[model samples]
Target: MFTAGHLAANPLPPGIVGALGLGGYQLLADIAGVGAGRLGSQAFLLVAADPDPALPDAGTQISLHQTRLRDESEAAAYVQLAAQLGYLRLSGYRLAPDRHGLRSRINLVNPATGAIAATIPDRAGGRLLRGGPGASQLLVTAGALPPAG
Candidate 1:
């Protein structure tokens, strides 16, 4: 489970605002990413299951943990991480036969409002990747909105 504070530290794209329940987990939003006319707060509910190297356990159950991305630089870093995690779905890893490098499809919606916000190519088999010093962070930017017209 993730708190809003955690999201604030990382990020949920720009319009997602933050995540609530990841399937069943309840997420809390902490006021950490809101400041100086910027959206900087977020919290996600995730479960981290123990990884079984034996037969590919195949799932994770993250607990309530917190990490912060205070400034835009940090936020950009997060975005970069997301991009590296093959989030964009457009220019990442190459699928099987289409090794020519085609973009995947990505779509993030507000489950509450039934609204579609972000859309990118989709990955053949999209799954959450691990995070670490040289890993891509799965910062969901689903509900965020574009600047005013």
Candidate 2:
């Protein structure tokens, strides 16, 4: 169950919700963990319940796992490695870079409809933006992350 206090205690970084445009979804779970490394970076796993537009009673769930990196350069390196390993080619996903080339993301396209089903941003500043159904239209609205302090 989601609660106001829980969200207040573990709030998502600014612009995350608007970036993903998760307006209608309901928060289900939020888990934070330590990244595997000497730095012991922070990581988070978020699960949300997404209501299906076609079927009122039927719904789906989406999850996003974000890791806090040391900096934008480190995050870019991680995305590059993932792409080199052909991880982005799985399931008909194509790698797309933002206009500024600061971020790279994998977009999953539906074969039948050719509509984007999901988007996974593997970019700088330690954000892993994952999107589910109805995300295709919103991705264009996602702006760059704020400068790291």
Candidate 3:
């Protein structure tokens, strides 16, 4: 359940039906925690979903046909790989959530030079802009916090 503030912080592309799903969310979390992919919300990462003959009774994987995927880990991996393979042009987010809520790393891309940079937008405020000198993005992932002393 996304809150109003979260929604405001991270606006979705107009007419994009459905949410980023739990699997997608988990993938983003893993990315932030493990540094698997770059993260950003500044630009949309183009993704397309396809069927994997591995899920059991995975309940209609129709949304995948166009990357309008449901919350599934397999789908997330597939998309992530696609992004990396250049099958999809990803200039944003090596580690960003499907939606915004807590802080998450955002991959900021310099469109003009095709360069990429990472930014922790204070709290995943949706903008992937480089935080002025020394500023950083903070992400809250499941069990990512250190044990309190």
Best by TM-score: 2
TM-score of each: 0.22, 0.24, 0.18
Task: Write the residue-wise lDDT of candidate 2 on 22-135 in tens digits.
Answer: 333233322221011111232222322222466452111112223344554443333333322122233333322222132224444444555555555432232236333222
In the range 1-149, model 3's lDDT, one tens digit per residue, is 22223222343333342433222321231111121221222222232212246743211111111123323543454345323422112322233222233222344343454444333232212224742321111222211322222
lDDT of each: 0.28, 0.31, 0.27
Q: How high a TM-score does candidate 3 get?
A: 0.18
lDDT by residue (8-42, candidate 1, tens digit) is 35433322223322222222322222111122332
Residue 98, candidate 2: Cα error in Å is 3.5
Instruction: Tell me how candidate 2 scores on lDDT.
Output: 0.31
Task: List candidate 1 stretches off by more than 4 Å.
Answer: 1-39, 42-66, 87-149
Error of 1 at 81 (Å): 1.1
Candidate 3 global CA lDDT score: 0.27
In model 2, the runs with Cα more than 4 Å from the true position are 1-88, 122-149
Off by over 4 Å in 3: 1-11, 18-73, 87-149
